[model samples]
Target: MEIDVEQYKKDLLAQGAEVVFSKTKNLTDTPFSYCGGCGHGVAHRLIMEVIEEMGITDKTIGVAPVGCAVIAYEFWNIDAVQAAHGRASAVATGIKRTNPEKFVFAYQGDGDLAAIGTAETVHTCNRGENIAIFFINNGIYGMTGGQMAPTSLIGMPSSTAPYGRNPDMHGYPLSLTNLLAQLPGTYYITRQAVNTAANVRKCKKAIRQAFENQKLKKGVSLVEIVTNCNSGWKMTARQANKWLEENMLSQYPLGDIKVPKTDN
Candidate 1:
């Protein structure tokens, strides 16, 4: 049964059925290379949609480093540059400073941001650089053989901590987003997720607000997305999402941690 796709869209439009969901042009045609149930793809879509909606597709620059989202440049249609492992935030600092008029952001994973790039990430926000950062915290290191990461919750098992994460042995999970929110240079900070439909909408709103801060020239705006690493966790997509909701959210709760002060 052959069906005409364009004509099908036309028929739906003729019936007065508005298309509420469609791929934003800010994304490339490249299919996501993430695992079947990983949240990076959904997180990526939210960011690109925000860029498109803000009409900054051409004026935007994104920096992605190592980990699961290393090939992010291929997915986002806007101008982007790849940085060395754990150097995305540092590189983004340079890019934003040189092209101060352009909107810039860094897309990084847990290991890349909270672990190796800890110094750069903290310093970038400390300086209150006018840029947004999107951090995806999947708990474990997804791309590097599922090793333990700085954000891995206590008692979570990983390749490095097969017995389960122990604070005495592995150190407690570092709530990086909360730490950044305390920095005076940081203008906006929030933690959100894409595990469910309702959460996805809220996460999208957070992403949009992060980008808007750039226009306002506010300091650093960070949005931490608590996500899942299904393959790394040795669980099916469905099982991983369920586990994420049960465990991950408890350590990294969703909602705004900091916002610009209102002068009423």
Candidate 2:
């Protein structure tokens, strides 16, 4: 018989209404610092919810980066270490290597991961590090004055690219899922979004799978969230959602890039 996991979860929660779910208490009560209509907050909440549901909050160690999620350490009530700009992957590798028992996750944005930290990200995945990377790709630098990021879509205007991202001048956007899927060391890789209820569900499932992949010591797992940066994109929350549907979703079609082979 197919089990109703949602109902089961709800039943469990209903039975202990007064007792806080361990993960719920781990996350901050205040609204996130992310800009309005920003996908970062939605993505963060989903991941946090899954982490709580799985009862892994106590053992998880998050490595936060310098971009919009630099203060992730403040929101997620777990042991966390702050990394320099674009250095979350490197920091995560060190932490996981030193403390193999803990669940290590690295949270970073496009500017931090695809730009300054590209080498570290690629190398860590190449080395088959047992860590999960939650990459938020909003296509521009949200914290640092809306500069064009490596993942910025073509024709998307930014402070640096006033005329939009030019092919000859700026090159192309980076597809992290597609790029990392080719690596044997990467056990789980998926592209997801947080624009709607349906997409949010998919993202949460992917994130849960990523964490499970890490728990099994399979290899590097990455969940690249095609998020929105309303502030940086210079669009209202509603406009940002519409833009994501028309622009971002088309460029970054969501799906799993890789899953561990059972025989492997």
Candidate 3:
């Protein structure tokens, strides 16, 4: 006999078991615009899920930069603002300062955050802005063609670096999360991935913690997610995940780089 998936889910719910999958109220019903196998959709869903779970969907605001996440305003049900290339952090800072009661976050990509937005990011963290910064580090400019970004691995190939990124020519990849961790203004800094089930759970927890830190009026909280850009990498979704596990994780290990010291 064929199992009734919906009936099984209903039976589980009747037994007081939580639903493992459901659409978050903070996210729109419209389909995602991201490429197939891209991690952006997953990240978006996770963030929205956290916000919904925290019951802050109505009071949270998101600032999206001019990268693949630029159109986030369309997907997120909460109020969202569009910032210029690499300016999401600055915009988020302003929003948080003006509306301290609201939860403000900036969602950005590697190219937008590590390249053109470097100064803004550093200064925002240095000034201790009470905001959450979600940095999606796919290592390439996924939106505007696959160009070499500041976080691209030494030998990763992009549209701009067809023969692989040369250290001599492109310089070494910027360890932005590590650099931010050293800044006194930052309260929490972590590097996470969404390529696996375990990592996805960890990533969701990290995002929730980051938002919780913001609620405490703490300094800047940065969650850098090392994701896969299958289209940009010129690899299938499965191949991209395998490559990310083998290559990207080594350069950007998953873990908390910094956290607040609790008083014993």
The C-alpha lDDT values of all candidates are 0.93, 0.88, 0.93
Candidate 1 vs candidate 2: the TM-score winner is 1
Roughly what TM-score does model 1 have, to 2 decimal places?
A: 0.93
Query: Model 3 over residues 189-235: C-alpha lDDT tens digits?
Result: 99999999999999999999999998788799999999999999999
Order of candidate numbers by lDDT, starting with the best: 1, 3, 2
CA RMSD (A), model 3 = 3.7
lDDT at residue 195 of model 3 (Cα atoms):
94
Tens-place lDDT digits, model 1, residues 1-264: 999988999999999999998898988989999999999999999999999998988899999889989999999998999999889989999999999999999999999999999999999999999999999999999998899999988888999999999999989999988999889999999999999999999999989998889988879999999999999999999999999989998998888999889989
Q: How would you encode candidate 2's per-residue C-alpha lDDT over 99-168 as one tens digit per residue?
A: 8988899999988998899999999999999999999998999898799999999999999999999989
Task: Indicate the residue-level lDDT of 108 in model 2.
Answer: 92
TM-score of each: 0.93, 0.89, 0.92
Which of the numbered candidates is closest to the native, going by highest TM-score? 1
Off by over 4 Å in 2: 1-23
